[model samples]
Target: MRNVILYVNLTLDGHLAGPAGELDWMLFDPEMNIALSGEMRSRVDTILTGRAFHHGIEENFRAQASDPASPAELVDFATWMISTPQVVFSRSLAEVAAPHRLAGEDLAAEVAALKALPGKDMVLFGGVSIVQQFVRAGLVDEYWIKLYPTAIGAGQPLFTEQRTRLELVDSKAWASGILTLRYRPAR
Candidate 1:
């Protein structure tokens, strides 16, 4: 079965977004982009996200993939992002365009079905509630968290709905102080 990887960026205080769900404070690094792209290329075949994050992710990457002015590394990453299949967990959306689809109402069941399919691991690029739901359901197999040095005092947190014990598997720190930590549920 494929693993469900929760890949996200968090502030120093562990929030995923600012108080208003804004992401302007998150630091962006070109080197991190290359590393992330390489990881995705090798391990991820599907993209999963909640409705709130789907539009921005799609729009940003689509534009980057097509824009001639985008950096080579970003363009490559954007191309991979757009080409990967995305499953959005949403109830109100009637339908999504090509390369994107709405997951069934049964979140756990839908994820189970996806995992049973033959493919590389799946990445959950979340917006708060979706991450909460998956964590509460105990469905995530791995966590890839990029912790930025910045701190937004109050914001949408990544683990507000669940308490999990994780074992760190690997970690890397960049010169910019962006730290990437990989963890798995403690056995």
Candidate 2:
């Protein structure tokens, strides 16, 4: 059985995005990138993100495709982004551009079923709102957070309405002041 992990970067204030839906505050250090690379390469295999993040990917692809010489670099990133199968959950979105399969069903049940597939762990890179759903469902087995040094006092929050406890597994300080944390549900 595969585990579901949330390997996403967040701010000290626990907001993955700013009020304007920007990640301008995340310092994006090499250590964090290295960890992400490790996760992509060896750790969790699948990449899961919400509709908002999917929109971001689409916009990035459009921007990258505009430059003719960029496809080489872009195709590489795209290959990595879609390297493992991806599941995007959206009620409003009918179709995605490429390499993304629709969940096409209930969120919790779909993800739970997906976890039963052959894999190490399913990486959940959420849009906070989507993460809340996973958390509420009690389906996430592990939590991996790249906590940035800076904090935005007010913005979107990482966790949501259904309050739950998480027990700290371990915490490491990256070279660039980001904190790599692992947590399991308190229960």
Candidate 3:
């Protein structure tokens, strides 16, 4: 079965986003771009995300890929981002557009079915609630968290209400003060 990886960015205080869901704090430098294009993008064949995040990402990447003045690395990343199959978990959304599927109420089943498929791997680009559900269900195989230097006093945290023991597999620190920590749930 393909591994289900969670790739997310968080602040020093463990918040995924600000109180208002703002992501202006993240430093998307060349190192990040390289990792996105060379590591994460190359390994994943599918992307799982929440509905709102899906819409934003789809729109943003589609636009970036089409722009002539965009950086080559970003353009490449955008191409993969728009082309890869995306599963958006949402109960309120009845129908969705192409290259994207709406995963109804049964999130765990849907994730299981995806894992059973013969593919490279899958990455979960979350919007809090979905990540919490997957984490609670123990569906995530690995976590690639980009920890920024600054802290958000109050916001949406990465882990909530659940106690999980993770073993650090690898780590790397970039010049931009972003620390990439890779972990797996302790067996």
lDDT of 1 at 60: 90
lDDT tens digits by residue: candidate 3, 18-96: 8898888888669765875588877889999998888878789989999999989789888988888888998788887
Q: Cα lDDT for residue 172, model 3?
A: 87
Which residue runs of candidate 3 sit more than 4 Å off their true CA positions?
Answer: none
- Please, what's the RMSD in Å of model 2? 3.0
Model 2 worst lDDT window (10 residues) = 71-80
Off by over 4 Å in 1: none
Candidate 2, residues 1-187, lDDT tens digits: the string is: 8888877788988887788777888785754665566555577667787888777666675566565776464555554665456788888888876567777668877976887788777788777778877887887888888898988877777777778799999898888998889998998
Task: Please give the lDDT score at residue 54 for candidate 2.
Answer: 71
| Each candidate: RMSD | 1.2, 3.0, 1.2
Give the Å shift of residue 109 in candidate 1: 0.4
Q: Please write out the lDDT profile of model 1 over residues 63-121, one tens digit for every residue.
A: 99999999888898888887888999998899999878999999989999999999999
Which candidate's lDDT is highest?
1
State the displacement of the C-alpha of residue 92, model 1, in Å, after optimal TM-score superposition.
0.8
